[model samples]
Target: MARIDTNVKSIRYPVPCDEKLTLLARKLKRTKRQLFIEMVDYFYRSKKDPADMNDEMLKSDLSRIGNRLVGFFRTQESELLVPIHGMAQELVGNTETVKDELKSIHEKQGDAEKLLRENTKHASEQIRLLTSIFDGLAKMEEMRAGFRRIMEGYIAEREALGWSTSSGKKDELVRRFRLKVDRL
Candidate 1:
């Protein structure tokens, strides 16, 4: 039972037996104010209330616990302390080892991530180069086809004007077309 309220109302009372209270307070090494507080707490605690069964049971249980209580620290060199201390030290060592392993793993992961990024960049560059090369080859093929069509048109017009479509004339036409393409 504790009262911790700061906003206490002032109380003043005259006790009928002042000499006895003063003597008792002196013998108990308490101030008159403290004696008053103790008297109030005792009076309320000893007051019988049929509704408060929990307090009676708590008192009975608390008395039993007090009677059975033992103190291990009352003796020197306890048997439990050495094993507990050894276990704690072993756990500390294991924790340090785990920390070291975790640090190594973290470093390796960083290196692996860096390597992956570099590989990705290199792969992307290679893909870009390959794509450009393919595009140039495709454009060259298309230009060759266009040139062939233009040469056919020229040969057809020459044939309509009575020029021979013999192998000799075909060789001449091919040579001229190649010369023109090389110049361009």
Candidate 2:
């Protein structure tokens, strides 16, 4: 049992003066008034009553209280410099390394993207040339069919007119007609 301080005037009652308060004071190494103020602060931070709290809500409240208790113990036991300084330096180094690696990857990706765009443009130009060649071939076939029809018609008309089939006149007539068609 520890002696209560006499100079403390702000001590609130219903302050558990039992085994719990005694254990808490020994654990915190704080006076009863200081522990009370800590408890009040914790309560203020944790109080949030749901409109319809159930057993799950009660469990959540208990978990928060347990967390506050552990935090208080950790604060009491914490060192001022060693863990904080060491962890901060380690985190800073890790972040810089990660940033550098990401920048390197981004540069590589940008180069790959540029290459892909150039390849795509080359493929599109090749496709356009192929399409134009096919269109020209189709037009040439149409012209060949039209020329064959005209030659067959002229041969039929000469046979019907009783012209000499073996004469060079037929060749001359075909040449003159072809030149006229070309001009048209």
Each model's C-alpha lDDT? Answer: 0.79, 0.79
lDDT digits (tens) for residues 1-184 of candidate 1: 8989974777655676677778999999999779988878875787745467677866987887776564444232366777788899999999999999999999999999999999999999999999999999999898888788767876775676465567776777768767766753
> What are the runs in model 2 whose C-alpha is more than 4 Å off?
1-81, 163-172, 180-184
Clashing pairs in 1: none
**C-alpha displacement of 114 in model 1, angstroms?**
1.5
